[model samples]
Target: MPVRREHRTRTATRTNCISAINGTAVGAGDHAAIVWPLLCGVAKAKYYLMTADFIGGREAERIGLVSLCAPRARVLGRVLEVAAQLARGSQTAISGTKKSLSNWMRMAGPIFDNSLVLEMLGFLGPDAREGIGAMRAKRAPEFPSAKLPGAAQ
Candidate 1:
């Protein structure tokens, strides 16, 4: 499943960009216990390098941070190849191309939001209410008649 985020696009999301980046998260109390003589920023960064792993690495990709993913044995080689490509390519050209793509698809955000609202509205209708109630009650619910009472007249 893709990571749920309001700030990104589907194509922009690669395996790394989801909740795929495995890392340790410390709550308020835990942070105080281990992180001392260090502020929040430093502590967060320290925690990342210390606890990050590949089990669910794509998590971090949700924000367009991770560039690629590979097995432990080949990660370095893949990184090198990616680095070489970037080095050989025109930085400005790539940047502009990506920027345009992002802007064009960004409008999908509001469309999804409206669609979700419409779906929920449907769920709140009598059909949905009957369907859910029937499921919870362990019986099939009856749907309303497809036609109004006087439609054939």
Candidate 2:
């Protein structure tokens, strides 16, 4: 009973936290990360996005993160070409298709909202304090792995 209660409490806390962030659209990309796990079984999406971990264009394309990579010098021309192609297509059909995709993508909104709240909660904790202090002190942040009060066990 205690374990069940703890789980419920933790879930409620998470939901509330996410709700707060969702209200502001601060975690919109989180929905994509959360859904990526469902569609592509990519569990590291959130971690990669949050940590600003960068992959090269080729690697991103290989992983299906991008359709193609353009050389730096040709990027503008490539983009313009794509835009012109899109503009030449049926605008109404393209708009409707985009809306459909957007609606499907929005299924992750709740999860993203929760993640944002958790992130905001982290900002109010010791780790955030230490991080800010380290930044002000001109040192690297030494984030502790210890669990805080509302953190999941």
Candidate 3:
């Protein structure tokens, strides 16, 4: 199924801009270790690291982020179609597959726990304050260097 973000106008998410480029960059720990796996999964983590996680429909489809791509106007129809298809499939198989995936992710529960702590540490840092300040001021954030102890250098 295709999962997409809402971006109907010129305005888009600041997270993408912040993460993709240097002025909008996040430190290695939060982006790489915490947010990456939680949001993009392990296999696609490298691409997100390089792109700062900015992805749209076509790009998402290209990288297997989404199973399908369609114009914004068609998103609902597409979702319905995909849902109907899945609904018609073997209910037991679908449930089993979903259960397996959930179990696999749960196996890494401890890692996710660590990631949350690391991310919270970022939230309490100077850069996080600067990011909020920059947003309020409608200016680009001047991110400080990623110097969190134990973060990759």
Q: What lDDT does the true structure give each of the candidates? A: 0.49, 0.56, 0.57
Model 1: C-alpha RMSD to truth?
17.8
RMSD for each of the candidates: 17.8, 12.1, 11.4
- Candidate 2 Cα lDDT to native: 0.56
Q: Order candidates by TM-score, high to low.
A: 3, 2, 1
lDDT of 1 by residue, 21-111 (tens): 2234333221222222122344444555344433244543432234455566676676677667766778778666767666644545565
lDDT of 3 by residue, 45-136 (tens): 77676446666667766766445677767767777777777788787887666565456445554665675666679799998999899999
TM-score against native, each model: 0.31, 0.59, 0.64
Instruction: Decide which is better by lDDT, 1 or 3.
Output: 3
lDDT of 3 at 40: 60
Flag regions of model 2 displaced more than 4 Å: 1-41, 44-52, 133-139, 146-153
lDDT value, residue 69 of candidate 1? 51
lDDT of 1 at 122: 66
> Considering lDDT, which of the candidate structures 1 and 2 is the better prediction for this target?
2
- Clashes counted in candidate 2 amount to 2
Score residue 5 of candidate 1 by CA lDDT.
55
For candidate 3, the per-residue lDDT at 11 reads 22
